[model samples]
Target: HKHLVQALRKAPQTAAVGFRQTVQKLAIVVELLLGDIPERAIFRQAPLRKALAPYFQLTQAVRLGNLQRFGEVLENFGPQFRTDHTFTLILRLRQNVIKTAIRSIGLSYSRISPKDIARKLGLDSAEDAEFIVAKAIRDGVIEATLDPEKG
Candidate 1:
């Protein structure tokens, strides 16, 4: 438990591979934590159910490999998670679809058009995608410069 706290605190310093591996590890750890909880303690108790809902939801998201939902939970119930002593762990799992998309693009293309990037990332508009691409480049997530005229 103390190790988990340490790991979460250091997550921002972790690279993409580190983030992936940590999430996998935390998923298993969460499973173990859940397995240790006595079933009778939570059974048929409304307040207990409500209190445990976020944990259950987070576990489900990790189990189901739903990073989007995991991010949503962190975004929505951050305060609740903090009170429950799981906020740092949940907060460490920052799911950025754009970042994932950028990684995929870097692997597949040397130079990609903005509209295509938008389509791959599921953005509603190419302009938005272009903005994201420029931001990503500025942030060093993507190494290539955006070609506005070409895009």
Candidate 2:
């Protein structure tokens, strides 16, 4: 707590740095408190779940697929939040899923075949993946080329 206070004092104007630092400190505290407890025992503690609800709420805000909203949530509540490994994995997976969806639709980065895109995006339905691709094309976010013979 003393170190956090000192850090906050050192950079009073930078919200990003301050938020990250505070979250890291909170994570450390949580890890220390729950590290030795069995998973079953930890889950049985209803108060712990209640206390962590705000963190989960913020995570859901981040996963809403908007960078601005994510940044705002981080800036607003990051200081009071701590997340476990499961949450971290969920966040990472969400990011990857979005990236894959974007790239699969050919609206981001490199171009890829539709089949490959569907696989990368983990879409069970090729038609659904094609819908995404078609939407990107319609929105002028991506362009498709035809072979000379096909054209």
Candidate 3:
């Protein structure tokens, strides 16, 4: 667990890959913890869903780039969050989508035209797709730029 936390702090360049690996490690830890308990006794123990609240909160803070809040969430609720499946899935989905979007957009940020995004995502029109793209940029999911030459 200490090693996992340390790795997360290092901020590897492959953020998505690193994040997924961290989650897998954490899941392993949770499984190990529950291994000794009888299957029937599991429910009688603290609800796994309740235990994960803190972790999910921390993950949200991290995604928003609020380092201070992220640290605080980890410090306060990290243990419980590790055990929660719902929170873990939410974070996993968020990470996966961001990674997929980044890979879809190539070298030229300006090359990612609104039409391209909309068509790829199967949206009704470019305008609707652009709206979603704009929102993603605002949310820090991806960066966008306009090139005078392309225009």
Which candidate has the top score in TM-score?
1
CA lDDT, candidate 3, residue 85: 39
lDDT of 1 at 103: 62
Compare candidates 1 and 3 on TM-score and give the better one: 1
**Can you write out model 1's per-residue Cα lDDT over 1-151, one digit (the tens) per residue?**
5565566456663355444344434543354344322233332344335545666666555544344676687777778767545566555443343454576687789877888877766568999888877787787776888776777
Question: Which residue runs does candidate 3 get wrong by more than 4 Å?
Answer: 1-99, 106-109, 146-151
Estimate the overall C-alpha local distance difference test score of candidate 3: 0.47
Candidate 2, residue 142: the lDDT equals 51
RMSD of 1: 11.9
Q: 1-151 in candidate 3: lDDT tens per residue? A: 4565465456454556536444544643343233211132322223333443444454455344343454566567645555543345334433333334443463335476767765565457877756666666666656775343443
- Cand. 1 Cα-lDDT: 0.59
In model 2, residue pairs whose N, Cα or C atoms come closer than 3 Å (at least 3 residues apart or on different chains), thus clashing, are none
User: Model 2: per-residue lDDT, tens digit, 1-151?
Assistant: 4564455456645455435444443543333233211123332334345554544444443334343454455566555443433334333433433433454345554545555656666667656556766665565545764222321
Residue 106, candidate 1: how far off, in angstroms?
1.5
Deviation (Å) of 90 in candidate 1: 6.5
**All predictions: root-mean-square deviation over Cα?**
11.9, 13.5, 14.5
Which lDDT value does model 2 have at 84? Answer: 38
Ranking by lDDT: 1, 3, 2
Candidate with more favorable, higher TM-score: 1 or 2: 1
Tell me how far the alpha carbon of residue 2 in candidate 1 is from the true structure, in angstroms, after superposition.
7.8
